[model samples]
Target: MIFLKLSYISQSRLTGLFSLVILWTLSTNTWAQKIIRAPYIQLAKSNSVLIRYRTDQATLSEISISTDGKTFNPSIKSTNKVSEHTVAVSSLQANTKYYYRIHINDQVALGDSSYFFKTAPTVGSKDKISIFSVGDMAAGETQRKIYNAYVNRQKSNYTNLFITMGDNIYCGGSDGCWQEDFFNPYHAGPLLRQTALFPSTGNHDYDNQAFPYQQDDSNMAYYQNFTLPSQGELGGIPSNSEAYYSYDYGNVHLVVLDSYAWGKDNFRIFDQENNIQLNWLKEDLKATKQDWKIIYFHFPVYTKGTYDSDVSGEIIKLRDYLTRVFDEYGVDLVMSGHSHVYERSRPLREQYGLSSEFSPEKNWPFNSSGRYDGSDKSCAYVFQNVEPKKKGTTYVVNGCGGQTAAHRFNWPHPVMEYSLDKRGGSMAIDIEDNRLDAKFIDEEGEVLDQFTIFKEVNKITKKTINAYDPIELKASWPGPANSYVWSSGEKSQKINLRPLKTSTYTVTDTQKCLQDSFEITVNPPLGTTKWEELIHQPFESLEIYDLLGRTWKSIQKEGFIDQSVMDGLPTGQYILEYRLKGKSYTLKLIH
Candidate 1:
């Protein structure tokens, strides 16, 4: 009986050992399915967000999101059978913060406090919006410094979105390069995970080939990695393709174009007349009811950087083709990055010609200082929003996010008010009410340049005056002016003008550095003596008077009145007043 019992105990122990081996194997397998790339957030709308990640082996993806950071009751799962996973979570609140945890095959991967995102404000909301833009950002310490500069500068300030002005990945935008150059530096790090990215395609991002050529290239990774707002998913007209699209954030309408794809000769999307992208842009701009209109692309319309828009065929073509559309649609700002330098133009208009042909009067109608520096009391470029025609659009080339290249030609373009090629930097823009404030913050955390554009609600008044009337012209402004100069040689706030001939009087507020003009025309008095017969319509009442305020004649007559009617009248200058049904006309006539 003892031997039998010992045998039974040994069998039981063997069974226990076998069970431990099975548990160990299961644990090892779960550990082997490691998360190779950390999860990142994208496509952040007011009510939804897309979470993407990758693992070492094929595994299902799951995510749990919570607003309070604790009770993650809402869970999302992806059914795609692959290592790379993307799961979209929807039905969220706008302008709210959310905490999330990533899971691989139902196993927790990331459940830390750092994994959180703030949803964009509801569309058309009056909330103040801020955005950070960088271009050609490659993975390295330099890129980190630029990002850190932005973070340190805006520590207390939260950004609504982050924009990449193309060349997102360096040395061919492959999957590996995207991971190394983009994900690790910007996403895996703390700066970009919270904000959604809106990207434009640079030459490198388009694989150095045109869009048509890239359609068949299986190696093109940009389309594979990014889930952009095509099909009018966010707002504006549907672009139908990811190559070019637009979105609305708060009061701003942002249009992103594929400059490299459309700028090339063989693969150009615009033919100076019509194309899908051009037509889409036209319709999109026409449909946007937003207060501020901003457009961004890869190639610059005007720049004096390494790539000259004046000489390059592609750049010239794009500039000549795009500016007319921008002007027609009243675009407020044009942002681009391809020159690898920081350059900003003054409030410019009608600059579609060659660089040599740029005229201050024609291209730069608003040539005042756009810098917010207190040297000039005018801190912002004010545009009256009443007119369909835009006053001007400020073109900014903020390409120094990761690298800086010196200007090969003249350092400054004719329309440029500020140009800096010294160091790399990023751009931060804040939109509040009708004012937009932009600053170029360099890697050193210094604001290299700053400007503000204010959309004024009030309209400028235009007036016409008769000569010899001595009309008092008053400058209608709310603030005190240091000096005021009228084109008619008057240097006072109010000027009495009695011009003998037609003239245009331009008033310049030297303190505000703004100019406004009005025109006046002179007319001679009616001559004495009857030389011509009077012609009148049927049932019209006519009356005649002299310069001495003496009535000559009054009659309700029809048809032509011959010279016989004035035969008995005294030879003197006279005024003829004609009256019709609910209408009256005054004419200077000779008696």
Candidate 2:
């Protein structure tokens, strides 16, 4: 270190020397550690996330991050010298947004306000989750447009995670293809920077120029580039292998299967009995208790797009085996991308036959459009554990993320309710509580098709009322049910009726796919019953009804209700009934 005498050094000279030193240090550090690949997020969880990037040469990597941009904490990690850098930051708050910047040799490599990530909501939290998924999205003009459409749709509200249904890189599926096709398009937007990736494998992703064009994971660029949560890292059974895995986000459980023969001695998803991949899938599905289970892979179980599911080799196996598993486990959605067209089937089960053999009466229980847009008979698919459990899986072939062309022969399978050909689009799924919305948004930001699914609806109820007494029944599903029809000829969710005698009333949604029944029994004028009135004794059960026999108030095991409980009641004649000592009592009360 050289120091000039304070008496001889002028202020101007001293300032100039300090500036020169700072500039030199920054320039050297930046030039030495040139970032080859921008930072991309991976394996994000409720409290942690992994960031991976590549540099020109081996250098120390550090991250400066903060919840609010006003302050930041730098975590100096990766002391080893390496071109590829993976930095993990932990102990973060759940479902929080954070801004981050990569520092190479203590110099800023990439950072901005837009460079931020939001953690996944707490594992089982009911927070609304938005997911974006695409298949066959090989980087090209159409791919970029689809990406832009998503970016435009989500200006500030970014997806919690993005999933690729395989075939991410086109052509040879080498490093060059990944750089130009995958990174080039993603780096131009906030998708990779802000969203964690969960990708499956496709046939083209295994293409390699090396000996044996279909190379193993060791030589496959697809495996080498991704850092998957393979070991129950994101809330699922430990898969150990990247070939296929499962993870949870909010209340959704997503399973990404490697349909292509690439893992464990090249065992494909369609292998015969005791297939390793299918075995793991069965175990995982059995273990997870999540509200929603979504399975995605490259081979579609039902499609009539570029490839016919009835004739395709792997799809046939998937249909024969996977449908049973999906139906057994009550899987909500099964997605795949290989046909280069869009096709969505009605909620179906056990239709593994050829297209000509499809029987809607047996295979598809919910045959509505499911658009929920007021179109003819269009209503959301409302599911429940009602008597005659109508648990079915909706199959989607979202293969038009990159390229779309003329559909194959018999483009729309008999099971499909909607089909779109020659349209490049991406799938956006929003899940909150029991309601899920899925949309196929075209490259022009137009929602070509959409549908809704509701879970845990009660299809049956029972009540006893006096003759000519009215009772109110409410629909269990959310949203306005005005388009529905009830046995009373009412077209709304809540309806009131006074049945003259014991009878059952039924209500059906607009699509006629959902139905609810109420069994109301008329009690033969309980006013004439002979029982000791509970004047001062606390009753075990009590119900108050107006002259119309409509239940105004009801309670069980509440001990007693004071006059204040009737404050809201109108001044009219009322009937109070109570059950005590295993006996019933009725009194005419005038309010």
* Candidate of highest TM-score: 2
Cα lDDT tens digits for candidate 1, 333-427: 89998888888987787889788998988777565666645565444677875653448888999887886778877668888888888578899
What is each predicted model's overall lDDT from 0 to 1? 0.71, 0.77
Task: List, in order, the clash count of every candidate structure.
Answer: 0, 2
451 Cα displacement, candidate 1 (Å): 0.9
Q: Which runs of model 2 end up more than 4 angstroms from their true locations?
A: 1-31, 209-216, 387-389, 458-591
List TM-scores for all candidates, in order.
Answer: 0.70, 0.75
Question: In model 1, where do residues sit more than 4 Å from their true spots?
Answer: 1-31, 208-212, 215-218, 262-266, 270-272, 387-390, 458-591
Report the C-alpha lDDT of model 2 over 1-591, residue by residue, as the tens digit.
Answer: 111110111111121111121100112233366788888887788877777777777666677787886576755444455566665656677788888887877777788888888888888887888899899886688998998998899778769878987888777878878888888789899988889988888888887745333323556778777777677878788777776889999899999887766446455667685677788889999999999999998888778888987787767886888888988888999889988988898888878767888898988777578898878777788777763456689999888889787788876888999899999999999888778899999999999889899887646899998765558987665445486688889998788776757888988776665677899998875444212333455788888787666788888874765665566788777777778899876676666
In terms of lDDT, which candidate is strongest?
2
